[model samples]
Target: MTDGLYPQLADAFPALASEIAELLRADGEPLAEAVADLPYYGPCTCTATCINLLTAPHGSSGSSMIQLERDGMDVI
Candidate 1:
């Protein structure tokens, strides 16, 4: 992870670091990998947002594939 990413994540969602780390490890999919594999051309209109590889070129697809849910509610 980049230095900027950690700070950004810490600021955006303070409680999700551990959860994110676990997911990344369990699936053996790092953030960069997830971002790279994301479907750039799709009919997904979900308003959620995430930081991934596509953002580097597509400049914020205005949506996120990873939906952070907590207590039965979507957090992201």
Candidate 2:
């Protein structure tokens, strides 16, 4: 079985992971152990948050445009 959200989150956003770990540690649960207890299945398609965030367009001064450059994430 695959590791839980923590691993994917850590890999995708280390800064976020560190922040989350700090928060969890303050609650007396270390990140390593906490993540170990988390359940992982497969891709999540239950909510629009993920899809919206991935495909959302961002604008500055003029107009909005789809980002053409993502690290290694597939856009399809």
Please name the candidate that would achieve the greatest lDDT relative to the true structure: 1
lDDT of 2 at 16: 44
- lDDT by residue (1-76, candidate 2, tens digit) is 2334333444555564455555555556544344323332323455645543121113213354322223455332
Q: Ten consecutive residues with minimal summed lDDT in candidate 1?
A: 35-44
Candidate 2 accuracy as lDDT: 0.39
Model 2 segments more than 4 A misplaced: 1-7, 32-43, 50-76
Local lDDT at 47 for model 1: 45
- TM-scores, each model vs. reference: 0.33, 0.37
**Reference-based lDDT, each prediction:** 0.43, 0.39
